[model samples]
Target: MNTRILIILALIIAGIAGWFFQQQGKISPPVNIEASEVDYEATDIKAVQTNEQGETEYELNAESLTHNPVTNQDEMSGITMNWEPSDEQRYRIEAGSAAINQQTGELHLSGGFTLVSEDKVSENKTAATDIEPIQVTGQTLKGNTKSRQVYSNEPVKVVQGMNRFEASSMKANLETGEYEFGKVAVTFTPVERQNKALF
Candidate 1:
């Protein structure tokens, strides 16, 4: 009887030890992830232009512009854009530190940039038509002396007439007076439309 009891106790202990080992095998160790770093640089840039209008044209300056040949990416530092004032809404012009694609001749402006419009209209004694802040990244841009078009894989905001629109992408044909946006979101303020009859 003593021998049989000892044998049973040994079997029970062995079973408990096996169960603990199985549970330990089921557990997985934590994984470690490492962070990555990116490196880049920029330098002094300047641009000047003369407009036919009598209004004084402004100059643009920047600290630096850079392009990564390995990634085909470009960047600009401390960019500035300026324009000449004119009574006639003649043309759309942009000047800034930009990265030009060697293959396609596409230009990309980066860092601090400003866009100014010559067209200004007064409505209800308020200066209503004004250029809004814009940030553009694109594959190419094509336009003429009178109009401009910017094509990109990102969104663009445009205000025309009394409506403002945002879209994922766009093709603006300024010559034909046509602009189309893909997956567009538009908003119109009621206050602007109220004065439409007066004009």
Candidate 2:
């Protein structure tokens, strides 16, 4: 698979914030947001969006969500989101916590999150190495639906097959698969050690 195609995973995962906020419609800006209690809460919430072509584009799930008035955003925990930009590769995310503006589809996440890019598992293990999965991890991330941008100023890491990358910051264009990383460090795992390190 093309490296460019594999990198599309970043764009899809970053778009989750946009999806989260879009699911919530017509939210009013509240005064005394800090005084607001949990207006709405749910244990399992799944929000799915489809394109004009009627293909599922993104599915966002959260283990729990709380309406916080002070921040005026939905407080979400145990978030697991998936995006299918195309039929070939899927992007998945497991995030610790996120804050989303219900009105604007702005998203910010903290604690930690892992984004994975992988093809559907096949019965044949022989081809697993052919299109190696890519992983990106960060302590913080921010997404804007209007701008279609996802970025992190904190250190970010990316791993693919036997290689690992660390960067001071990462910015990816959601509309394009273009990625920009700051101060990067790349390490290639030796063949003898890769089998033990990779999942």
Candidate 3:
């Protein structure tokens, strides 16, 4: 009887230990993670236009465009362009969001678009440069083709000589060499002498 009792106690202890071991095995370890999911989308797309003289004259669907006042750099995304050059004064242009540099005059364009010219004279001139490469900087549009006047019905900012203007919308008539700014306020930097006089 003593032997039987000891055997029974050992069996119970073993069963309990086995059950404990099974429970321990069933527990899952904590998961370790250092990163999470991220979602990104494109924003602020626009189109722009300019003349053979390198003046920005028009823009279409002009939203999400930004200009650095200090750097004189202009950037636009999502573009559709049309250009027509006149018969006289042969002209050339380089444009793109990536190509724009106030200091260097390089326009960078992205999103894969074409630089087209409708004018015969302009097309001949453009053939010289292989229709200027549109440089792209992070999906932005840029560059001008030689034979075509740049056209965009989007909102636009124009830097013509000493004058800077922006409009809710714009249209450039390359044939007539004229640009119409939608009813909008234009801004320009004051001359240094004029600013000094005010102070």
Candidate 4:
């Protein structure tokens, strides 16, 4: 299936998370990480990732984060993430809990996962327009930072403008922009036609 937008959405999450993993060491002073021991702990964490042009690409906020040295995993609670690939669009994601593996570059999100995509207009020399935002909801999301692959076995729903799609499961390759869905259902609303009184 064609899922360019979703691919971009997942990639935004993966790319930013990967960057955060690489920089986690800088977030705090060096701590002796022993097997089965806590590496570090932090609260009220807020981080931002910027591109080469010095433009903010992603922002993350969380209530608490803990890292385990033995497992090489970072677990977080009350997570909120914002991703902006360009001036035209922004995506916001929220979850109650998440876990990222520093060694494997795997991220697992659970506890009420929601992703919202919105259209953004630049303030400088740009035309303003209104468009209904898109939203994706699922129980869990798993992404590989190195491979740029995203998959979920639980039920997933996606809303784009006036259209809706639901599936028993979903998988996507961000690198190739490929999407696969299982037991999919789709609903498309002809807003323009309704406005023209063609229905």
lDDT of each: 0.50, 0.77, 0.46, 0.78
Q: Using lDDT, give the best candidate's number.
A: 4
Compare candidates 1 and 2 on TM-score and give the better one: 2
TM-score of each: 0.38, 0.63, 0.28, 0.61
Candidate 2 vs candidate 3, TM-score winner: 2
TM-score top scorer: 2
Which 10 consecutive residues of model 4 have the lowest summed lDDT?
188-197
User: What are the clashing pairs of model 2?
Assistant: 33-69, 33-70, 34-70
| Global lDDT of model 4 | 0.78
| Superior by lDDT: candidate 2 or candidate 4 | 4
Task: Report the C-alpha displacement of residue 196, candidate 1, in angstroms.
Answer: 21
Put down candidate 4 lDDT per residue, 1-199, tens digits, no spaces. Answer: 5699889999999999999889884746567864657879999999776766988877889999999877788899999978675566576879889887856768788997986765567777465566566577899989865565668899999776767899999886644444688999886565464345556
Q: Is candidate 3 or candidate 4 better by lDDT?
A: 4
Q: Give a tens-digit lDDT track for model 3, residues 34-59.
A: 54332222345555556658765434
Kindly indicate the candidate among 1 and 4 with the higher TM-score.
4
The runs of at least 3 residues in candidate 2 whose Cα sits more than 4 Å from the true structure, single-residue gaps closed, are 1-35, 51-54, 69-72, 85-89, 120-129, 145-147, 188-199
Candidate 1 lDDT, tens digit per residue, 1-199?
A: 6999999999999999999999988746767765432255546767554445634444556677566666454555555544333333223334344554444534455332223344445343456445543333333333222233445456656555445667787664433334567898866455453434654
Sliding window of 10 residues with minimal summed lDDT for model 3: 132-141
How does model 3 score by TM-score? 0.28
Off by over 4 Å in 3: 1-84, 89-150, 188-199
RMSD of each: 15.2, 27.8, 15.2, 27.0
